[model samples]
Structures are given as C-alpha cells and as structure tokens.
Target: MQWNVQELENWEELRTYVDTALLPLYLYRPEKPVKEHVQRMSYLVQVAASIEQRLKGRVLMFPLCYQIGDEPLAQRLPAGFAHYVLLQFSGDRLDAHEGEGSRLRLTVGDEDLESALRFEVTIDVLSQEIIRHWQHGGRQ
Candidate 1:
C-alpha cells in the first residue's frame, strides 16, 4: 500500500494487517543541479513503489523524505508500525538511525542502477530482507 487517498481510505480496516512502514530517504542538495536530484529521486521512488506492490497488504510506503540539514531523518516517522524500512540510495548523505521498532536499511547502489534487470534484482533483495525481518519477529 502507498500513501495515497485510495489506499488510505480503508485505513481502519487495513491497519491490523499492515505492520511495516517503508520510508524512502534521499539527500537534498540545494546547490546541486535540478536534473540530478530529480533523476535520483525518481529512481528511488520507482523502486519503492515496486516494493510496496509486492508487499501490498503488509507494508505502507510513505513519501520520499529528503534530508536538508544534519537532523535525524527517521525521527520524522510516527511511532506506530512494528517495523520501519529505510529505503535509500547507497551513497545518500543521511544515515538515519531508528530509535524505535525494528529498523532495516535497504540501499540501491550504483551497480544496481544499470538497467531494468538490475533494478528488479535490487527489489528482490530488498523484499527478502523485509521478509527476513518478519521471520525474526521484527528484530534487527
């Protein structure tokens, strides 16, 4: 599930099955070129949307959160879900540490950015990680 009006309409009913929250983290470099930021964020968003589709009933993907200053990013998330998955580019500036629940870091590195096949592989790896989190009872 995603953070859209359609998906959130039945929040009360979906709340019980959705125990994980997927938050995409990206760096916001104001001085950088606009195109660069858009390209990077677009890729991350695509990857996240695919993941949410694969794990629809169990995960709710939040919007992309771009880090501006040195503040903690994970702190932005509410304290409700059983697990929080931080999706980000491997070389992004912010490395958020979750203070609550089981936190999982799913990164997409340069090597994984080559083509559609690579992106699919990245998604597979990330999906496995999330499944592993559930198997371990939402532990590290």
Candidate 2:
C-alpha cells in the first residue's frame, strides 16, 4: 500500500496488514548541479518503491522528503504504524537519529556509489531487515 487516494479509501479494510511506513529521504545541495540532485532523489524513490514491492501489504510508502545542506532534520514522521523505515542516501544528518525506537534508517550510497548493482544489494538488505523486524515483533 502507498500514501495515496486509492489506498486511503480502502485503508479501513487494508490498514491492518500495513504495519510499516516507509519514508524516502533525500539530501540536496544548492551548490551542486541540478542533475546530480535529481539523480540522487530518483535513486531514493526507487529504493523506497522496491522495498514496498518486496514487502507488499506490510508497508505503506510516503512521498519523497528532502533536506538541504546543513539544515536541521525536522521532517514529521508518519503515524499509526508499528514500524517506520527511513530510506535515504547515507548522510551524516540522518545518522544522528538512526535506530531510535522502531525506526529503521536504512541507507545506501554511503560514499561514491555508482552502479545499479548497489541499489539491488541495498534493496535485499533492507527487505531482510524489515523481515527481521517483523520476526522480532517490531522490537529493536
């Protein structure tokens, strides 16, 4: 399920199966080229979409959220889910809040990450982590 009109309309019936919320986070630097930022953001969204596809009914994906360089992290996380997964291209700003409670900050492209293979690898790792979270009953 996803955060959209159709899903919300059937949320009353399908909400029970959705125990997790996926928030796609991307970072943008004003000084950088527009193309670069767009590419990174696309990758972040692709990751969130892949995870949602892997988990199917267990996860609800939110819109792409972003942070500007050096700004404080103050995005409002989604509510009413047993787990919150923050999917982002690795950065220091988000690292501070990693592993707080049921939130799983799964990141890819920590450094100079180039290649589709990296995205697939990250998707697998994130899917496994979510499965483990479910197995543990949503505990840390």
Candidate 3:
C-alpha cells in the first residue's frame, strides 16, 4: 500500500502481512535545465509506479523522496522498518545498475530515455530482481 493517512492508520495490521518497505528515491540535478529535470522526474515516477503495481500486496511503497545533488538520505527514511529496500533513480550517470546493502540504483541512461518501452522493460527487470531478493529473505 502507498503511504497515506488511511493506510498509515492500518500500518500495524499491514505490518503483519508485509516484511519489506520499498522506498523510491528520485535523485535529480538541480542545475539541470527544467525540461531535462521534468523528463527525469517523469521517468522516475513511471518506474516507481510500475514497481508498486506489481508488488502491491507484498510491499509498502513510500512516497517519492526527491533528492538534489548528493543530499543526505538517512534523515528522510521512515523508522521501524528492519527490511527496507531503496530503489534509486539518477539521471546524471550511465552507471545504471548498482546494488549494495538494501539499496539498488538505476540510471536513466540514454537507451531508457529514448524509448518508453525500453524504460518499462528496464523497470520490470529491476522490479523482478527486487522481488526475488526479498523472497529469498533479502541480503545475507
């Protein structure tokens, strides 16, 4: 379930069914042009939505956390989650895939930026990877 007052009210009960919290971090360059920033944000939202749709009952998707240029992330995270997965999307690099600890970073590279179909496919594959990791009890 998405983060909201209604859902938050049932958080305790929801906790019983879900073991993982999925946080989507949208990282963008404040110095970039408006059009570029918007495009990147659009891609981030679409990818995040895709993940939420596929894993609706199993994971709780927190609201999008927008970060500007290396801003600290620790303070933005919600408390009480022992199994948390951070899915980060950045527009400034081609180093699209990286995973360590509980965070996975995907770059909105040229290929994904050029075609919506490719972008969706990339999101699907990444989402599946996350689900697989979670099902196997997360990282060791």
Candidate 4:
C-alpha cells in the first residue's frame, strides 16, 4: 500500500499486511539546473514505484524526502511498522556507502542510469535486499 488518503482510510484492514515502510530519500542540490533536477526526480519516482510494486502487501511506500546539503532526515514516518528501509538517491556519489539500524540505505549513482537493463537490475536488487532485511528481523 502507499501513503495516501485512500490507504489511510482503509488502515483498519490494511494495517495487518504492512510490516515495513519504504522511504525514498532524494538528495537534491539547489545549485543544479532545473532540467537535471527533473531527471533525478523522475528516476527517483520510477525506482520507488518499482520497489512498491514488487512488495505491495508487505511494504507501505511513503512520499519522497527532498533534502539539501546536510538537512536532517525526515522523522514523520508512520507508526506501527516492524521495519523501515531508506533508499537514497543522489546525482553525485555519497561519502558513506551504507549505515546501520532498523533502516537500510541503498545509494544509486549515474552509472545505474546508463541503460534500462542497469536500472531494472538495480531496482530488483534493492527490492530483494529490503525483503531479505525485513525477513531477518531488520538487523543491520
């Protein structure tokens, strides 16, 4: 399910299947051109939708978190989830590759955008990783 009014309205019945929350973290640079930003945003939505489609019943897809520089991460994640996965995307490479906790961060860069095959593979890997992490009780 997704984080929307329709889903929220059916929360009473839908809550049982939602054990994980999928949060897409988009890192944007204010100095970048509008075209570049739009491309990145498009990729983010595509990747996020792919994941949600694969894990429809088990995960709830939250809205994207647009952050600039070192802005604090979003803290308004809905309650009652057994696990949380934070997928990060940026135009430039990140310094730290990964992190620890109930949250898992998957970072993607320019190379992953070179071809449709590459993008599909990356999303598949991300979806699998999240499912694997959740199955293991979200121990990272």
Show the colliding residue pairs in model 2: none
Counting clashing residue pairs in each candidate, in order, gives 0, 0, 0, 0
TM-score of each: 0.88, 0.85, 0.72, 0.81
For model 3, the local distance difference test gives 0.64
| Displacement of the residue 84 alpha carbon in candidate 1, Å | 0.3
What's model 1's lDDT at 71?
A: 60
Error of 2 at 90 (Å): 1.4
Give the TM-score comparing model 3 with the true structure, all chains together: 0.72
Identify the leading candidate in terms of TM-score. 1
Off by over 4 Å in 2: 95-101, 110-114
lDDT of 3 by residue, 43-81 (tens): 766676677778777667777676567655443445555
Q: Go through the candidates in order and give each one's C-alpha lDDT.
A: 0.83, 0.78, 0.64, 0.73
Q: Per-residue lDDT of 104-137 in model 2, one digit per residue for the tens?
A: 7777775444777877888899899889888887
TM-score of model number 2: 0.85
lDDT of 1 by residue, 1-140 (tens): 89999989999998999989898988776887888778888999999999999998999999988887556565555577888888887866565553477888888885545499888888899999999999998876
Task: List, residue by residue over 1-140, the lDDT tens digit for candidate 4.
Answer: 87789867987898888888777777677787888877877887778878888988888888877767665544555567777776676443323222333666677665546489988888889888987887788876
Instruction: Name the runs in model 3 displaced over 4 angstroms.
Output: 5-10, 74-76, 90-111
